[model samples]
Target chain A: GSYTTSSQQPSKLLFRQLFEKESATYTYLLADASHPEKLALLVDPVDKTVDRDLALVKDLGLKLIYAINTHVHADHVTGTGLIKTKVPGVKSIISKASDAKADLVVEPGDKICFGDLFLEVRATPGHTLGCVTYVTGDGPSQPQPRMAFTGDALLIRGCGRTDFQGGSSQQLYKSVHSQIFTLPKDTLVYPAHDYKGFTVSTVGEEMLFNARLTKDEEAFKNIMANLNLSYPKMMDVAVPANMVCGLQEVESKPC
Target chain B: GSYTTSSQQPSKLLFRQLFEKESATYTYLLADASHPEKLALLVDPVDKTVDRDLALVKDLGLKLIYAINTHVHADHVTGTGLIKTKVPGVKSIISKASDAKADLVVEPGDKICFGDLFLEVRATPGHTLGCVTYVTGDGPSQPQPRMAFTGDALLIRGCGRTDFQGGSSQQLYKSVHSQIFTLPKDTLVYPAHDYKGFTVSTVGEEMLFNARLTKDEEAFKNIMANLNLSYPKMMDVAVPANMVCGLQEVESKPC
Candidate 1:
């Protein structure tokens, strides 16, 4: 199916999962290992932790190529805009359906490639209509099982609230069952955020243990109705700031 | 040379990194993938998170053979005893010199094995006199570079204080350079705890960037001396509770 040669492939893939405690967001840094260029990309970076992420990138000698967000977050403004401002050629990417401003807009099935490694995008809405999951390739030849970057659609033993942001409990259930649960049992699940300290989970584990997802749709809807979660504190400012690429607000400040 | 045949080898090694937010401690779960027996081990679990960690181990269908502590911690009590209370035949491990009671005592060059994977214990005693670093094997045939579980001896861009519990800056410097730093440059470093959001680093990165360990012996001693760090709030309770293995304190309390 592919024509790439062995020498052209990287010996390893550099992966790091970083946390932003205030919003409990998880940001991901991915790059190809042993390549001279050290091309890298980030997913779901938060505005508050740009400095720390940038320093890490510099320390690893990785070249920034893209800053991608799975959705426009209500919890925190994204750092893509700040990253672009700091790194001359970096591009910001978001799902076109989100109606957010980004340098490049992607749709489902699009391949986000960094050297030989690529994340296949899958549209998994209901947490937010534009939500997408980035999945790695899987096969006997792949170094590791597929990893699902399930923004807010999935969490460890939990799922994102479908009470706001065009959220529909029914739609979320459908999306997860169709797009994510079908992955290989061992596929690692990395979410966009976590309130609990869990860092990762597997598709098999979640299929068996995910609280709301395991219930029937009606029960899940009932649970969602009664969740009684207060409106997110950052939603008012973060949503607007995030829609325009998360940089203008930071730049708008005199500092 | 390994006499083990291909049929006996596991398809993959199951690894999970769990976090405890209160203390910023990271607990590790490791097992051989696809083995019917599913024997597993945990490293550096915290007292506050025994329930959460136990639930996960059960969810993963892993048999807990050992609950190993890299050292008796001052900031928080270890969870080995509570784990033992819940799971039968689980051994609690610590360094023999730590002066804390554990079911099994380890010395340098000790091999802690589960299935085909094993961690080579190397005594690295600078943060505390009894501190040890557990390193995985590395070579052309290994799946990944060695992983050093450097319990407080090293953290990301920092090292533990040498202000108490047989602390010595010069001794720490000697232990690190002679034991940990001598490992392969690419060996991944997994510390017992981290204040910052970083979860892992490499021996090479820490060698160049570790704030305390990178300094010359004299300079390192000066930094450790002037830290002015406050006495650990939980030291009085945690240290004593940890000495007899962490479960007795919990048993002493009632509903």
Candidate 2:
């Protein structure tokens, strides 16, 4: 979170941005004081970098109301389970299709209300079968949802790999075109990872510049097929490690 | 070892070459049937791709012999341990400083005699602490060695990382200039990994054109420092996994 000042107005909201150095993962904490309990939401946090996020949450004196994962990340270990351990009372949310345990299994069109702001779950499963994007807005007042948390579904310049578990080039094409690209052009697109420059971009920017997503299904498939040569080197270890949501295992040893 | 035909001649020796598709790793087998009781030597093999190499060896009716790793690899897993496991009597050889379990550990000037061929171990630790290059010649015909298996220490157009364990930029500079560069300019340099177009180069070719090794030590260090920013994403898991030599517990578990 790089926030330097706070808003005094009761109706206004604040969002703190955080980065995980190793994977360059971005985690955001959205807070609204207008809510009765000073509730907050954490999005796509990384494992082991929670202390800093928690400190920001504490400094703002907001109760962690919900912890959500846009999808199970292929690039870095997830911190959902770690956050669950620390903030026991907070509800854990994910897409209903995800295999991981979640307190609230959300789906498309599902609205999660948090005071003056609301998060609308949009099933955008191109990157992975269970991936989703959370559109945050204030309804008519903010007529268009100006922000989206696009997990790994859509990066600034590249779409996620379609060769991983439950990934489909066709599905990804449709998701990007119908659900994401249809969003307001000015809508801010925040992704899970950005290997290249710039942390965020507008929906219009990605539609115009994202090489893979803008291509037709056949062209997209060709690109994906060529990328099949290199499998994730960490897949063998990461998948199993992430299965239990990054819980540090107690070694089995001689008692 | 890309020979196509085998002949029955008391004076002749046979060899076979196998390439692993994933990492483009090459393994070579050299054998002389005049000494039927003696086994052949396997060099720089890759894991899980032994069937092809085994078939070639069987075609020549040669017994499985010794296994050697030019160096501990960073890009691909090595199959020295697996080969030793499958071939009961086969001994594994690596640099003495490698600290892994091997039947024989050799240093520079140490000769490994296998029938008609003599492999001379040359300590080339710039790549990693125990990195070694094997200087081999056509025994009596070519009294002087002409081929060098420079594992990552020297690539076709570049060199290995000095930021890894026991790696020193200064040591690499000395090793290249004082040891490898001192070799005959026409000596063949076969590097362990080549993602680019080249598979091999002459000592003179590398000395004249290699961007890093050809430059001054300070300039080389600056390039290395910048390249180091893109750290191997698999470093945390790969090193520990490779230490035990390519055995993954997940192989036994369901995907």
Candidate 3:
């Protein structure tokens, strides 16, 4: 009748994708299988769904380790700050190039480790100057296909709009082509947000089907420029809150 | 860029969860590895998102062989008829007790197989007269934790309402305890619909955390009777349409 925490599953690595409907944001939970303590981390958790996400962690008997952001988001405040406030000792991580405040700062070539699993950081800036993609280990030696957490640089059939927040279409085009597309085609791509109900995609699928990125660099830039998209409704409030490890003024509800 | 179907991955099995937002329904695409033809099946696909679902199936280069419904849903139209129309020769499956006209009728103790993988059919009829939970094999021999496609019988933290369509809270309580909950505690539980943005839960998690079924049978029945749920707006249209293997009069849009 109530939430229950149980150490039930053993030897299975945890990888969960949670959603926040209002913003269509995707939050990822990753953990290592061999770690008895069940150290875990959340990526791109939204402020509105922090309680739900934390309850999940508690129910699964996982110890929250870090709250990670691929970049400073333009929509929906990040849950990293609230998560820290709720779960003491939980650290926040952001890219050093993001120039945002966080407990830990990372850059290209850095690896974030939890138990036996690790994610390689890749500088993939285009939608923003500091966006990065986190990728799990890939190779014939690995047990599973690689996973690439491409925040806004890439999506299922499209890429994020490069119209504001120091957005550059050219940089994004180059960033994805060089950094993300080059990964093994089978690598699972988990974007920070999806609007079309797509939960996941593969590098190969995007390489063949991605509407914007498949175009030449010039064509991609023109498409980005000509598309007169509306300004994000939550950008004004979300960007500021997300910039400082997600310190939101609103205490009760999401902005 | 356009949609591309690449035969890229060599070894990984495919299991994707697709969402149709209007009804908060989940559609599962499951396939067996080791099959070069990439035979696949869909579970509880919604009609409104048929185009999106087909595109995904095509992009993954999976051949649709079966479209199965755990039960005739009341919230949304089933995509089975449309899928069969588009992908010729695809079979539609439903329980025999449902009295629905499908290409194939399955009862308990049956195994639906594709390539090397098979889902053991479990008769968990509580939410409706003909609800079935599909589960991959458990025991130490399986590759990973078993997955139970609970449909509407059992949800993440809740079970389906036993209000209409021969729904009996008593039968549901007994059915879940005997059929679904008795599976391995580590088995992954995927429900047919989720109002909350939860995607997955474990057998143990639901066993301990299920808000409805965790209560005693009498208490569970009382909760079901007192729910005072609104009359389903789509039931009149959805029920009649889902009866004849999901044939719908509306051609262009969802009912």
Candidate number of the best lDDT = 3
User: How do the predictions measure up, each by TM-score?
Assistant: 0.92, 0.46, 0.91
**DockQ class, candidate 2:** incorrect
Q: In candidate 2, which residue ranges exceed 4 Å CA deviation?
A: A1-11, A141-145, A247-255, B1-255
Which pairs, if any, clash in model 2? Answer: none
* lDDT by residue for model 2 (A51-161), tens: 767755664568887878888677677677678778878777778766655667788999876666778999988778888998876455432326788988888768788
lDDT of 3 at B7: 15
Cα RMSDs of all predictions?
Answer: 5.4, 22.3, 6.8
Over B113-140, each residue of candidate 1 has an lDDT whose tens digit, in order, gives 8776678899988788899998875543
CAPRI verdict on model 1?
acceptable
Give a tens-digit lDDT track for model 3, residues A82-128. 99889998889999998888889999999888877778899999899
Q: Which residue pairs of candidate 1 clash?
A: B126-B172
- How much of the real interface does each model capture, measured as fnat? 0.27, 0.00, 0.26
What C-alpha RMSD does candidate 2 show over the true interface residues after superposing them? Answer: 33.1
Candidate 1 is scored at a TM of 0.92
Candidate achieving higher DockQ, 1 or 2: 1
Candidate 2 - chain A - TM: 0.87
Q: Interface RMSD computed for candidate 1 is what?
A: 11.1
